[model samples]
Target: MELTDLAPLARSSIGFDRLLKLLEGSRLPEPADDYPPYNIEKTGQDAYRITLAVAGFGPDDLDIILQPNLLAVSGKKADSEARGKGFLYQGMIQRPFRRVFHLADYVQVRGAELKDGMLVIDLAREIPDAMKPRRIEIAGGQARPAQIDTGHGG
Candidate 1:
């Protein structure tokens, strides 16, 4: 969808212009790469996890970078020319890839791990105290009436 499609949302919403920019920027000009599949799931109320199938890739081959508003995951196969010498039917894919994810405000990367050929990344959203909801105390009653004194001769 184009930015024109989001004009209604932009007009109706407030403080979400960055969201529109992110959505517009995420659209790839070329066809999306399907290699190295990944999944994002909500683990808790404010926690999330991203799992990527990275078979034949070691820790040295992958790089995870967390920027202010972007999470980039890149991988480079180690010396494929040396390993790809002879393979009649090579089904395993070990090509280089770079995947990027847009992060919302207050969303942070907690940790990451590679297990069973799966790279799992943990994320959590931590809203600041200033943004959290707060309750206001109400007064029990109204103020008392004030007495006025008039000037009189004693």
Candidate 2:
């Protein structure tokens, strides 16, 4: 499944091109709709966290890699070496899978932890001082005067 020309017109903005690409790439290899369920949360103005339900997966079975602007999560459950017991009905899942998430500009993966059969991935975004919203001070009674520099070179 892919997002059809996802918000193309957004390119009119100054720095939305990269965002489009990130969205596009993340959609390429759709993460398995199954396996450990996950949730993405926005904690602060620039902080985010992804929680995954990895019931039978242990810390050693999971791997998190951060490269440049890409964050990838992968989990591989160890195969069982038990005898085939008589079971008319069996309902258990044990498969390996990988999920990739593209991080936007200034977004960084902080860390990941497992607790209560849940895997949590932490992310944070830090905007530069100049980029963050700022209020321009208005002088009470100040008029800016422009000086015209005429090049008078012989």
The true-versus-predicted C-alpha distance at residue 72 of model 2, in Å, is: 1.2
**How accurate locally is residue 106 in candidate 1, as Cα lDDT from 0 to 100?**
90
Off by over 4 Å in 2: 1-17, 22-32, 80-90, 129-154
* Tens digits of per-residue lDDT for model 2, 1-154: 5468666567566767776766666677754476666788999888999998887678988999888678888988655521345557656554677777777777888888999888998999877888989898977876788977788754
Worst 10 residues of 2 by lDDT: 78-87
Number of the top-ranking candidate, with lDDT as the measure: 1
Candidate 1, which segments miss by more than 4 Å at Cα?
1-4, 8-14, 25-30, 80-85, 138-154
What overall lDDT, based on C-alpha atoms, would model 2 receive against the true structure?
Answer: 0.77
For residue 67, model 2's alpha carbon misses the true position, in angstroms, by: 2.4
Cα lDDT tens digits, model 1, 1-154, are: 4534667788899988888887666674755687789999999999999999999788989999999878999999768664767878778888899988888889999999999999999999999999999998988898888966666734
